[model samples]
Structure formats: structure tokens, C-alpha cells
Target: MSRTGRFGENLAINGIDGSYGWPVIGHTFDYLSDTYAFGRTMRARYGDVYRCSAFLQNFIVFNSPDGAEFVLKDEASQFSSKLGWEAFLGRLFPHSLPTMDFSEHRHHRRIMQSVFKKQALVGYVPLIDQVVIGNLRTWPTHQAMPAYPAIKALTLDIAAKAFLGLELKQDTHFINQNFIKLNNGLAAIIPWPLPGTALHQALKARSNIFNYFSPLIPQKRRSEGQDIFSRLCQAQDENGADFSDQAILFHLSNVLAAAHDTSTTSLTITLDLLCQHPEWQQRLREQCLRIDPQDITYDNLESLEEIEWVFREALRLFPPAPQLFRRSIKECQFGNHIIPANTQVMVDCGYIHRSEHYWNEPTKFDPERFSPARNEHKAHPYNWFPFGGGSHTCIGLRFAIMTAKIALYHLLRDYSVFATEQARYRILPITKPRNGLPVILTKN
Candidate 1:
């Protein structure tokens, strides 16, 4: 590995004719510094599909819409998510559905789906509305605040109330700290347990969540409450098979982390986008107001079609989980190119979203791209996978949309949102503003 920016002759690949790849260090340093940087560089040099070495593996990045389509919608088994994040998340959330595949994955996903259905969320409407209103009431009437942390608190509160049927005001700080530790664990370069390490703290947080929810699972079972947690406690498959207490707890933990974290990340991005585009924000605000602001019912929620489009656009620009990786199950040829088995494969959503062929003005903040008239995403289904595609698409997609819309509805009704000039934003794997998203909210 040379200190120089150029890869020395010693690190070149032979089979690809005169072409070269990364050497001993290869693109590892570049990737760690910024995966998007590497993707942009590689895509420019090698076109849509290119092979690069990372973390001591020959990884192929599918950078085009067609390439992603092949990777996601495979006829034969080729991709595996477990190979990428299982070892780390397994420790944090043992036996989660995402950590499994095939029959096992299907079985768990079926049980998980029961909790996220429209009927279940209908039951959560009052809980979500109350959480949003309660959090909004705490915001300073005419002060500037970082939107990420504020949205995080609101989303966490919603997760606590809607998922666990428990108010988290007394333990909000603890829960927030645990959530931060859990996210840091995922971002860690080394995903191993060490004394005082991020992974270790995340493991501890997992312990805390399980301990907090264990006793309540039985209580929910006894009372048979209308909340989703209670529904999960007694949910059964078509064959009458039910999840054991341990399985239920694992699923609950994963759901809470997934539902809240990704949604909060998404809401933060949405807030940032809305703040940046006040014309669109005013449009969305008008839409929300037209449907009776006092009554935040399910019907009114559904009528928020424009807000939904703005959210879809925000996700297009800044998806929370931007890059997806999978390992080859067997040796195969991708478009006549040999992709050997065990090769690391990546789907670069960030690049695909910015690609010129699929989108008209790729970088612009145009919510109309998602409108029924344009619906540019419909140009290529895989072109816009904010929540991924295929069988593994987010089961909680509808719930996430509802949560974002409801939060935005409340925020716009009483407050005006605009980005802070002093705030400089950065996009990590999760699209949070590196500097907290500072936004001025005036009482409207």
C-alpha cells in the first residue's frame, strides 16, 4: 500500500486484460472515507457495472437501473443480506427476521406483517397524533432548533406509545441514548464486542429493551389491549402457529428499531427538504389544511397525497439506507461478465438516483417527479428503491409513510420551517445532517 493517491503497479488485476483494480489496501481507505466518492470514481472509469476490492473481497457494484434490476429481481438465488450485517446486528438484536432467509424469513415476516397492517395503524392513529402534538407543544414558539433530535424525540415517543403501548417521557433520555449507541454500533468500522465499544453498548441497549418489554409482553397478553404490541402477543399464522415469548421479543426489538430509526431519519430529511423548498412546503401545508386540521382521522391522513409525493422525493434524494450489499451464492455471469461465487455485490442507490438516464433533472428537488403525471420512478421500478425492492421491501412502508405525513401535518399547521444558513449538512450512510439540522420554526 503506497502513501501516494495512485494505486501502484503491484496492486493491479490480471484477468481483466489491461484494466486494473485496487491493490493491497485497494479502495478500502477511499470507501471508508466516503463510499459515494469511490462509487462515483469507479462508475466514471468503469461504466455502470464495475469490480472493486473492498475489505479484502472482490466486490461488484451495479451502478445502473438495469443492473440493479438484475441484482434485486433474480430468478435464481444469488444475493444474501445476512452475509453483510448479520454478525453485528445479530448480537444487537438476536434472531431478527432480517437476519434470516427463505422459509425462516418468510415465517417471521408473516408474523411481523400482522402488526404493520392498515388495521393495526388505524388503532395507532390517536397514539401517533398525541405523540406528535405533545412533542410539537414542547418546541419553542419562535426559536431555531435542530430538527433531527426534535424529530427523533417525537418518533421515539411514537414508537414507545404505538409499539409498546407505553409512554416514554420518564425514560426518553435513556431510550434516546440507547438509540444513538445502537446506530453508532452499525457505523463502527469494527463490528465486534470490546469493552466500552459501540457494539458492546448496543448489546447492552438490547438487554435494556428486552428487560423493559419482557414483563409487559405478558401484561399485554393478559389485558388484550388494542395496541400493536398486544396484537403481536396473540398473533398467529394461518396454520395457527404463534411466536414464542423469545421470538416475539426479538421481533418487537427489531420492529421498534426499524420503525422509529428509519422513519426519524426519513422525517429529518423530509423536514430539511421542505425547509429548503418553501413553495412546496406551502403547497403541502395547504393540502393538509384543506382536509380539516382539527380531525386527524385516517380519511384525512389518506387525503394527504401531495405530502406523500414530497416525502417520496425526499427519499429519492436522501434515502436512509443508501447502499445495499449482497454476496454471490454461486458463480454466475452478470451480462456476460463472470461474477465468481462469494464475490461481494453492492447496489449503489445513491448513484442510481443521480443517474441521468432514469431521471430528467436528477439532482433538482422536484417533488413533481413523483406526481401521477410524471411518475418518473415508474420509468424504472428499481430506479427508486428508498425502502429496497423485491421480497425484502420494507414491510412497514405504509406505516412509515403515515408517520412522516402525520408529523409533517402537525408541524406545518402551527409552525413555519426553514433551513438555517449557519447549518452545514453532511450525508452519512443514514441521511442525517452531520451538523444537527438547524431550522427556524415560527408560530404560524
Candidate 2:
């Protein structure tokens, strides 16, 4: 309630403990080099709630479930998702759901909710299976395959058909290339669209995407197709509000990116984990073998309980989006600290996901932790929120789960995946294998 002290000045006096590191650059290099190590070191030094500087900004890192609740729930409306995501995604995905706050976010979310509902999701299973099965068939067996890029391309193909309603023959290569550019821009240090910069190329890609989708909006609106694009075109809220032409483009761009990237990361990690743990992989494969390959539907997808647990463990170990960002709109109390307004707040879900305080053998890749008998994740609501929590929780979470389940079921059923060697990961920005997670897929 008291806005008595500025963020940096008199931090000790204000009871918030943290260091600003070096001037201007702050701890950007340290943080970027290895976010997991940096987070662990910080938490060890300062407990759960601490302040540190990164990427030229000071952030109060909340590395606990309670901190996750306070910032993510934002019960007092004291935080802004729009302001939080602006630094990362504003240039590429302006006015998208992630960049909207409070009532505006709710309004937009309501209109788009129908497209991701149970019925719609059920309709997508066959399409997803088609893409997954078709792509998996093309993967070379008995050799080391780069899983990340291969899966990334497959996810883009899935998105093209299921989300954009595009035919397989369409120019998905252009879409894939542009999306890669846009993703590269998220890590740009400059953040400006200056000539020859990653941001500049990303902005150009954004324009190209807009131009590609803009003319098609009118046709989609009039059509009766069931793909996400058509459903979004016909989406309307209780108040009869609909997405404008530009809103549709923005939502599609953001949704497409989130859909593919997160799913790709999740599938790749699950595959990697399964490869590393042959016992779990065999168990999951046995479960998958029980289901008739022709009958892989939304109804039967839930039967693969071990597969679900494996996916949960994979997300727990390496969340797709490690650190979630939020900016304070007003001074708020997080535990004992009085965080100043306009301060950037990061909920280190990645750190908390692996914290010793929460789980037994936290770093161990044991899927049984999520089994009903153990259920360690149930100890706290926020302990396992990979798709995030609260109002801004990913709308496509169910879709992501379904896609992963289907992809894993088919891949594991046909081929036995083996890790050639231990794979290293790049944690920040997004969790991905540094070496693309090379593995051999031997056909059964």
C-alpha cells in the first residue's frame, strides 16, 4: 500500500533484497548464457523472492508457487500482461491475446474460446493424426535423426492444415521461414526494427504474413469450414462482437506461433526423455500398442495414461516457456517485499518446477511422480503449471496435449527411439535441445 521507496534506491531499507549487477547491461550475459544456472544461483543466494537485472531491465524474480499465484492470478488487477509481454512480443504480435490485459483480454478470449472447445478439438483429432502419421512415415529409420527441426517442420505442417485450413501443397515453406524469422527476433538485444537487424527482418516477415492472410479473411468469414481459421472468422461473443479483419490476422499469427512452437518443444522433449529412459519408453509403447492404430480418436487418447504422465514429467523438467513475465501496474506486496509499480516481475516457473522444496528427487526424469499413486504435482496448484495458470492460461492447452499424445502414440508404436548420446539444452527464450536432440528411430 505504501509507495515510499523507488525500486533501486534504498532497496535494503525497503526490505526487497537484490543486486542490479553491472550498469546498463546488468546480468544479461549471465542470464542468457544459462538461465537455469542463473536462477538456481539466485534462489540459493536470496531465497524465493529477489531482485536482479537482466536484458537492461530490473526484475523481481519470484521463484515459488505462492509467488506464481500472486503474480499470475493478479487478484487486485495490479499487473499488466500487455506491458509484460511488450518487450518480447509486442512488435511481432501486437494486440494478440498475450498482449491484451484485463477486460480487453477477457473479451477477445471469449470470442476465440469456441474454436478451442471440446467439440472443435474433437474434430481436430483425425486431422492431427493424419499429419502426425504422414510425417512419421517419412522419417528415416535406423539412423540418427535431428528430432527438433524434424518435429518443428511437422508441427508447422500440422498448423498449416489444422489451423490455417491450407492444403499440403500450399506455400508452407514461406510460412515456416517467416515464423522462424519472427522467433529469432524475440531474442534480439536491440529490439528495434532497424535496417539489417533481426527485428527488421522479423517485422518484414510480420508484414508478409499479414498480406498473405488479409485477403483470405473475407472468404473464410463466409465459409463454413471447421478449421481454426474458419471458426475464428465466425467466432462471436455473447454480445455479438466479432474479430475485426486486423484482429483475425493478429490472433492467427500469435495462435499459429504458440500452437506449433510449444507443441514442437513439448514433443521433442518428451521424445528425448523417452529415449533416455528406455524402460518408460517401453511401458508407454506397450500402452500405445493396445489401441488400434485406425481408432486413434479424442475419446481413446485419454487411455494412454503413461503417455500423459511422461508428457507431464517432460514439461515439469523442461517447460516450453520457462519464465513468465508480468509488469506491475501498481505497487503490490509479494510476501514481505513492496514491489514498486512499473517493475518487471518474472515468475520463475522453470526454477520452481525443479525446486527441492516441492518434489522428491526433483531433477530425476521420473514420470511416476505424476501417477495417481504418487501425484507429487498435486501438492501445490502452481507446482506444475507449464501452460501457465490463471486467466491467461494457454487456450490451446488441451489441443497441445492431444497433439502430443497422438504424435507420441504413433511414433512410439512403430519405431523404437534411442538416444545416440546425452543431449544438451538451451533453456532461455524457449526450452530446446542445443544439438537438435539426435536420436535413432529403429522400426519395430
Candidate 3:
């Protein structure tokens, strides 16, 4: 298949660009095998925007910052983020912010905006600190501990407290299990809700979660608390319409997953990097200790600029969300190409972050690349968009960063963290460590 429905003066690149690589499962195996390698190979072969079929659709590849900005910051309203990810994420988080489009996206986002404001962090941080402390205390010292599951558990505890405004001791296991099911639903090959399948389990889990959260909305509305849920309960769009119970459930489910999984992934990777580079760990510890060894406030958190740089670089190397998807809602000009409406497009952040075009040494783990004197990310506006860019950027970006930094802050203060041995990784679903990211811990 070739580019179709060109509008007016612009023209898309011609030819059946890139390898289809097996029908029905076209490019899916290659992509899942190594997303970065596949993306790099495709970009090398077919300039920036090439057409290649995934399992279902032929995605217009945009492995550049310019392409990202074009799709994400669509001023002409020509793209749909909701439609782009509908196949994978829509069933799980239907009415949530990530899947909402255009004016509706804006409206929902505005209502929920208060939950992530600067003032909100003041309340959330203390709760996170307590949770981090409790979670980290469970880690066995001077021995190999699987950091992925540990971090996943820690982040969930933090998410439960910070997002839902509850400790969730009893339901944590159940919630975490359901959350994994929902995430696993993305890789379903059959791609339908059948009996005894991942998608079916996920749908069931989603229903269970909604049932769990059903009774909590009225209390949140009747009272105002510092939790994200409480703020969301009171949130209203410009039309002055409060979120109904159903809307709140959908949003809560979205927020919990968004906060939990990504934080776990990024923080685990950060720990891996820190353990691999002990000097960077020492440097971050020094910066963190400069404020208060155990106590990191919102004001002082800014002072740990070096650790912040490390976190940013970690995000660059392994962004929580490695890809951005958009569907052409109307005819739109992308560079010399005119993308027709109803076309699926993607911006591969994993490729862009590691691309030689933006950074001098893209694969190296040098945190200093993000420094003021050598600000490599500023090479292009969209070059370092881990939380994505433009209007639909992750609403929990602030919360995620703050949570990770604070957690790491306390972690560095208390533990001498290091890798027990080498660990391998794959980028399917998301970037994941093969051996569960085993690390050795010692009391500092």
C-alpha cells in the first residue's frame, strides 16, 4: 500500500516504503523484538515518515521531533490521539484523559488540572515519603533483590495513597494484580474479549475496579481533601458540569494505572543506571543530602539539580512512554507529505531519544548531557518528550517526577544501591528488564 488522499499542494513520499515482514502480523514481531532497532532501521531506509504495516494498520512512521510536534500540537485540529490509541487503550480507559479528543480532552483536562498543581504536591509528597519508607524497608540488604517487582509495589503504594487518598493495605495485592492484567491486555494477539483470555481478564478487572470505587465519589464531593480523587470530585469544566460517578471511576482507573506503571518503570531504570554508575549515584546523593538527607520538600527538591538531571537523562534513555500515536482526523501537511484523514501515525520516542541527529553520543548514560552548559535536549523542542508534548502531555508528569525524585532521595540516603549482576532488556509492550532487574542493597 502507498500514500493516498493527498490534499492540495503537499505530497507524501511515494513507493511501498519499508518491509511489510509477514502478513496479518506485519512488522509486529520485528517491532516487539527490538522497537529501537526496528525504528532506526525504518528511519534509515525511508527518510522520516514512511508507511509500514503493524498488525492491523499501516503506520506512518515519524521518528523525528518535527514530526512529533506536527502530530501532537495540531493547531489545525487535524489529528486524533484518541483514535490513534483506540485499538490498544480505548477499551481499558475509554472516557479517560488519554483517550479523549479535541474539546472534550481540553474540558476533562481542565477539570482535573487542580489535582496536579504546585499546591497539590505539598500534600502528596509527605504521603509518598511515608509509603516509600515503608516499601523500601522490606528490601533485603546485601543480597540480590528483584528491583522491578519491588519498585512496582512501591509505586503502587504511592499511587494508592497519592491518587486515591487511601493506604489500601488490604486491596493492594488485588489492585496490583488487576493492573497487570490491564497492561497485559495490550499484547493480546487475538485482540478480542473471549473467555479465559488476557482481554477478558482485563475487562473483568476494570469492572471490579469500578465497583470498588463506586461508593467513594459522593464523600469526595461532600468534602475537599488533598488527594487527586477529592480534587477531581470537585473539578468542573468551563460549562460548570461536575464529573458524574461513572466519569470519576474512569478517570481514577486511568490515573492509578498512569501513576503506578510508569513510575515503577522509570524509577527501576533510574536505580539500574545509578547502580551501574556509582559515581552518578554518589553525585546524586551529595546533591540530595545538601537539602535534607531524609526530608525533601517541594522548595528544596528544586535544589537537587544534579539528581534532577540524572532523572531526566534516565527518562531520555528509557522514557516511561516510548511512543506517541495520532490518527489523521483531517488532511494535514507533515513536512513535504500530506497525511490523509483516517491514517494512523506514530512518533517513536525511543528512536528519537537515541537518534544520532539530536544527541552527539545518544546511547551513553552521561547525565551531564542534560546540563546547562551542554543542554543536548534543547537541540529540538520535541527531542526529549518522554511525558509527550503539546496539549495532551501526561497530566501526572509533575506527580511522576516528584514521586520518583523523592523516593530516590530517601532511597539514596538510606541504602547503598548497586546491581548484583548484568541484566538484559526488551522494548515490547514497554521497556522491561529481562531478569526482573536484580540489584544488591546495603544500608548506607
* Candidate number of the best TM-score: 2
Itemize residue pairs with steric clashes in candidate 2: none
Clashing pairs in 1: none
- RMSD of candidate 1 to the truth, in angstroms, is 4.5
lDDT of 3 by residue, 16-102 (tens): 265656776778887778888888888888878888766455667788888888888787888888888777787888899878898
lDDT value, residue 366 of candidate 3: 90
Better of 1 and 3 by lDDT: 3
lDDT of 2 by residue, 195-246 (tens): 9998899899989889988999989999878899999999999989899999
For candidate 2, report its TM-score.
0.95
Off by over 4 Å in 1: 1-29, 55-58
Give a tens-digit lDDT track for model 1, residues 1-444. Answer: 212112111122223322234665456566666666666777778787776665444557788888787776665767665654443355766577666666787887897788888788788888889889988998875566888888888888998888878877899998878777776676555545788877788778878877878888778877657667887888889899888888888888777777778888888888877777889878887887786666887767988988899899888877777677666666677776776665557788887887676799888999888888988999887889978766678888888998888898988877788777543444543456677888888888
Of 2 and 3, the candidate ranking higher by lDDT? 2
Quote each prediction's TM-score.
Answer: 0.91, 0.95, 0.94
